[model samples]
Target: MNSYIRVSLAVLLVALAPVHSLFHPGVNTITPDAPKLRSLGAQQGILRSVAGSQNLKSQDSLRLKGGVTSILKSLKDALFPVETWEMPKFFSMSAMMFMIIYIYTTVRDTKDTLVVSTCGAESITFLKVYGVLPAATMFMLYYSRISNIFSKKALFYVTALPFMAFYAVFAYFIYPNREILHPPIPQDLDERWKYAVSLLSNWSYSLFYVVSELWGSVGVSVLFWQLANDIIPVWQANRFYPLFGQLANIAPICAGQTVAYFAHLSDKGDDAFGVALQQTTVLILAAGACFMLLYHYICVLGERD
Candidate 1:
């Protein structure tokens, strides 16, 4: 067999392995050891002491004033640092990361909701077999090949521009034609083939799920972290990483609200799925572009140093 064919089969097997494990019940299950309550209590006490120490530090700082002003000052100091060159990079990267996480969450939710609604539960298993697994393997391969050929900065554009174009095309043309692309299933199919045929019939939605899953791996995990580590210095990272992590936690709350608001708008429409897809596609593409631009600026800054 050709090397490509072998790789393709490997990808399929790897995808199917998870589903196989899920079916075999106790084959994978192991009895849990008894909980170590004494050890757990000790760890909880240690955590409480550490948190108490941090709270004391904040209290010390806030005690300078006696009223609400003291509380406000402490909160402000905790969130925002004294301004420095690194501060802008920190804020920009945090904002970009927020957009990336928000868009990924929104798109993934939209795709999964659409798939389950349109094709049902078994379609999810079929999609893993036919869609996500292949896309993930091919993405890794593409990233590997490109990392060897392109500079980190160039690689961002190489990967991102194509995806932006894909989303754009999907939003403007392909998504609108989703119903046409996924035609009604034939009544004559063999019983064995019917389930598979039903899934294949909803190809457009499956493809959406595949692409949305890739955004987390390729767009956020690979591209964003690579750029962050490249720019952020080791010494500063200890202090700044925690702050940015807090910002990351807050991002999901904001993203959830944003998604809910759009979902509300979608509910008002006659074609809710179509409206949601259109809204999410535009948001994903816009976020992707902004992330690329921010990354380009970071690259430029790195070169200047």
Candidate 2:
């Protein structure tokens, strides 16, 4: 089995290398800005005029608040709704959930994944897929008192509730119009069931449906990766991050495949179901972040026990 796997990988790499090379010939062969090429004919002249017109549109801007005092006032007003009202409610709910079960699950799941799959033969073993740097660090650090400081239950409830309430108030008022939450649908139901069984499911519309559904998930995933760089630690991350991150990158692909299958079963167009699936994931992540903050507090408090 091992020999066959190695042979297969070798063949796959050989097949892809030439294809990659042929498609991306070097930049040196490319011509510079084509000044002469711009005046091909009347059509080219019109194209250039339109391009110049569009370029002018790019220069427009708002020159509001010429000084620091006005800027400061603007900032305060922008933040006021969240700071005054929404932050409090969010934190209140967060704290309640934290007192119930936030950090416990995180720690438990981490331990389970680590202990169960350490250095296994599985194609995507937890350690190999996730890397050893962080996992090893987490195991080592887990025994340290400093790392455990935030692991207590009592400390969690004390620290979690107040900050969460505060953050929640701000979060709520910050974007009062934003509706981020969406509940999940039944797991067994497929989206395609609607089209498979219904006469009104237009084939041409399916193309638009699929494209719109994918654009959001993909576009947002790209945005989140940009967001992650600002907050994710460079070092000691392997030691700190949970085991599930090993499969995190592949998750979207797996999810797309799974949901596509479900859509086929449901008779709903694949695109429609894909959109719903991605929206459902976004809702879960938002809720999970709130819950995780509370859990952190509980873990700190539990250490006292």
Candidate 3:
């Protein structure tokens, strides 16, 4: 049926061609509609050209649209690179990881400022062996006991809140009172005993250093990774982890800018370290809180699924 229809249409078009040309006016021949026919052909040509340009324009638009789509898909693959269903958990977990590392960098920097500025650089080596080691051991025992008692979510706060509180007080209170809090050691004391005395003298700074170190070791290495291992499936853990790890570089850039800005603003003053410590402490607390919120959100997402 379709073949017959095509043959009939072809025959009709062929038969009409001569009939249509019979109305044409040649250069020597004159007709009432010669001008009209010439004008009509010209108009037809104009219409044909306009339609062809319009087709080209539409094709160009489609090509541009496809290019934009391809670029967007590439960005999505680079950034998230997770399945559509995985996006919620992936985004939440990755953001939380970024926030954790950001705050940790700020805290570690601040801790160094507190210890080295007050007790000198040599004090750090002594403080870690004498100070951080014992504290880590005690924290390990406490963590074991609490692990049995508190829920995982509650344990996060239990572990983090003290670190956060110490950060607040050390910067605002203890650091300001270092003269009274840290005692003076005699000039002639033995080298080995001198650092021990300094560690004892500047107990607050030592404690700050210890807590900050543990926060890095325990708060992140143990708490966060453990949670991540549980929440993310082993099959997919390979996918989005690296993306967020690189994303963490963003934190250091912002942190470096903040430190430089504070240093610049306070360079002339005797309180240069003081100013940087306070600013970074504020940033650490803020990032820590954001991380807590993000963790809770990710946990909720996990439960929902």
Q: Best candidate, lDDT-wise?
A: 3
Ordered list by lDDT, greatest first = 3, 1, 2
Would you estimate the TM-scores of all the predictions?
0.69, 0.19, 0.74
> What is the lDDT of every predicted structure here?
0.77, 0.38, 0.81
Error of model 2, residue 188, in angstroms: 40
By TM-score, who's the top model here?
A: 3
Backbone clash count, each prediction separately? 0, 42, 0
* lDDT tens digits by residue: candidate 3, 139-229: 9999999999999899988988888898899889988887887778778888768778877877887787788789878766876788888
Q: How close is candidate 3 to the true structure, as a TM-score?
A: 0.74
True lDDT of residue 41, candidate 2: 68
Cα lDDT of model 1 by residue, 145-220, tens digit: 9989998778888987876676677767887887787889998999777667877787777777888888878767
Model 2, total clashes: 42
Candidate 1 has an lDDT of: 0.77
Off by over 4 Å in 3: 1-75, 78-80, 83-88, 267-272
Candidate number with the higher TM-score (2 or 3): 3
lDDT of 1 at 85: 70
